[model samples]
Target: MSARRSARRDLRRLSGVALTSLWLTSLGLPAVFSAPVSAGAAGSWVGDAPSVRLYTPGREVVSQPFLPPGTPMSAEITSVSWRFTPPPGSARLETRLCHPQRCLWLATPRGQSRALAGLAATGPFVMRFRLPESARPSAPLRIEGLQLIVNYH
Candidate 1:
């Protein structure tokens, strides 16, 4: 009778451990395999007849552009800015843009400049460009060249 009782207790403990492990596995694996979801909807605007594409953390790419010439052309991204809050307990905001010739790195800085090297694939990416102070909204900026390749991981 004591042997039977010991076996029953061991089975109960094993069942409890198995259920706990299963629950943990279900909760942990989705976060590991899936992409981080964004908190709010992404937005876009066009300047100088250029195109804008925004990729949210939920793996949705929103493409918006004002094709002035009625033909598809590369949009000059003068500025890109956004606020991101990453998931808890892990580093987030790894985004980048790459072209055939080079890549550019975007950072949260207060200035206007061009990126010398290819874009880095990490962090809170913010970019600013030097546009003429007198530039008007109606004035069409020539953006017939270049393409923007965006990525986030």
Candidate 2:
């Protein structure tokens, strides 16, 4: 009882704002959550978790298996600002965001091009990028600045 009181007091002092609400779970645990008073830009979606760099390969003459899988599909994406950087000798790349049987490829104009079209159903999905058999990277590839606008339903 006193601990919950102390927690509430601490949060109040820390937030420096009016107390919204406090929730106590069946397990007798008090949790604090906050909501932004002002909304972000129109048509924006931030995932509960950030997108992560899948893998960074080292220099060697062997094939890396592939990316395992990503978080289950939670929302539909509307627009994307995505970029992938491959090292020297890396070209003729084919990238895909795939379901087990069906897949969607990244539509990029820089190298070869394929456009991403349609929605990916919610389920397990893996991203696979293939380099031409004759091509190899001397350094690891870096995925940078990926921002997605999502359709939340």
Task: Give a tens-digit lDDT track for model 1, residues 75-102.
Answer: 2333333322222332222333333344
Winning candidate number (TM-score): 2
In each prediction, how many residue pairs overlap at the backbone (N, C-alpha, C within less than 3 A)?
A: 4, 1
Candidate 2's displacement at residue 55, Å, is: 9.7
Task: State how far residue 113 of model 1 sits from its true place (Å).
Answer: 7.1
lDDT of 2: 0.40
Give the worst 10-residue stretch by lDDT in candidate 1: 63-72
| Per-model root-mean-square deviation over C-alphas | 18.9, 12.7
Candidate 2 lDDT over residue span 1-153, tens digit each: 699999999898866533322324544665566565342222323222122332333322222222213423433333333344444444555665444455556666132212332343232334455555565556445443332223322
Whole-model Cα lDDT per candidate? 0.34, 0.40
Per-candidate TM equals: 0.21, 0.35
Any residue pairs clashing in model 1, and if so which?
A: 103-118, 103-119, 104-118, 104-119
